[model samples]
Target: MQDAAEPPPLRSRRDLVKELSLGMVAFGADARNLTSQGNLTPAQTRRLLPAGLVAAIGGELVASMAYLAMGRWAYASAALVRQLVEVEYLAWAVTNDPDDAWEWLKSDRQTRLQRWQPGKIRQRSDGRFPNSDYHAHCEAGGHPVPEPAMNILDHRDQWVELSLYEAAVHGTATWHYLVQAVGDAPVTAAERHHRLIDEAHNVWRRTETLDRGFLSPANGSDA
Candidate 1:
């Protein structure tokens, strides 16, 4: 049976993190707040995270946040798409079961996420940095992965959800990246960005098509 009480709406990133963090705190999970620490600083995380797998997943999240904030919808979606694949890598770290790890993609994220454990927070290896870096602070340091992170990596029908990000959002976010690639020079920038975005769209669509061929139909999605 599910909890009948509704949780409060998570309209901001801070809210989401706070909600997740509360549970982990009781376990003596990393105590430093992400905002207080370096939240999405990949350069810092890469060096600090003990496991390469954690670094990779954390890097993808950083890329997603960076691209999305810049209005690069396709790139943002791309980052998220990669996370779907990378979750398998993370799972392999935990279970060492290739078959089970691969299933992380087809797994229903919403259902699995409901089982998410509280996220860990750790003190920095050095005091020079005021706060803990999210990835390095994990219990594994760089080895085993947590079940919650595995669940968080799964995408809920990401094939369709990604399409919405690529197509349904009016391409405004897509345009943001394109504009920066070219400049305020007008025609050149417009043409350059358009071509770049179109190229990215085609690549993502093609990849999705290829991935569809491998999905297990038992997951309820049609082949």
Candidate 2:
């Protein structure tokens, strides 16, 4: 029998984008919708989480390559691409951690919010973190044990939400300019894209550490 033919090679981010397109189709109708929403259905989350993670990385590469290839610049698309990376990382990180991580991801708010005192979640008379849901237990970043990162994770998740919102604003503004300009202006876009790449890399590493039990008793991070 003849030997099997060699597999094709990935030549560029454009190629990766095609690969992502395949992975994204696995998400069915909600693939595009889920990218912007705060919460995902359990079924959608299960199918899209891995694809989202890969998509984020692939998007970054595409943005970088496109930015560098440009003689001028495109700022808005670049920023959107970067923000997307952080957003995907946050989703993936939270979904993979915590006992009820999926439920956490399903929340309109990705983290538990409450007043924290010392190392515990403090109840408030003002009814803060309204309609309290998840317990105060978060381990993302380098937060040690006996600490109320439930509050912190809530804050971080909020920030990610806000960042993406701002990104959408800028993106809308730039898309108009990009259309008028015939193509994108690459200088500003490249700058923002590169910066976000660094930030995304750091966030991924930090979250991955948490996923590996960075705060566990065996890790010497437990307080």
- The C-alpha lDDT values of all candidates are 0.29, 0.31
Candidate no. 1 TM-score = 0.23
lDDT of 1 by residue, 1-223 (tens): 2233423211222222222122112111121222136663543232222122332343344334334534534323433433332332342222232232223324486733542221210121123211221232231112244542342235434322332332212132223322232222222323433454454444343333222211224322223
Winner by lDDT: 2
Residues 1-223, candidate 2, lDDT per residue (tens digit)? 2223422211222233332323222222233455346465555454344433434444444444334323222222223344333333333333333223343335453244421221222132133221221121123222243333343234443323322322322222222222222112122332333344344333333322122112234323333
Worst 10 residues of 2 by lDDT: 128-137
Clashing pairs in 2: 72-186, 72-187, 73-185, 73-186, 73-187, 74-185, 74-186
Query: What TM-score against the true fold does each predicted structure earn?
Result: 0.23, 0.27
- Model 2 misplaced regions, further than 4 Å: 1-11, 28-73, 98-100, 109-223
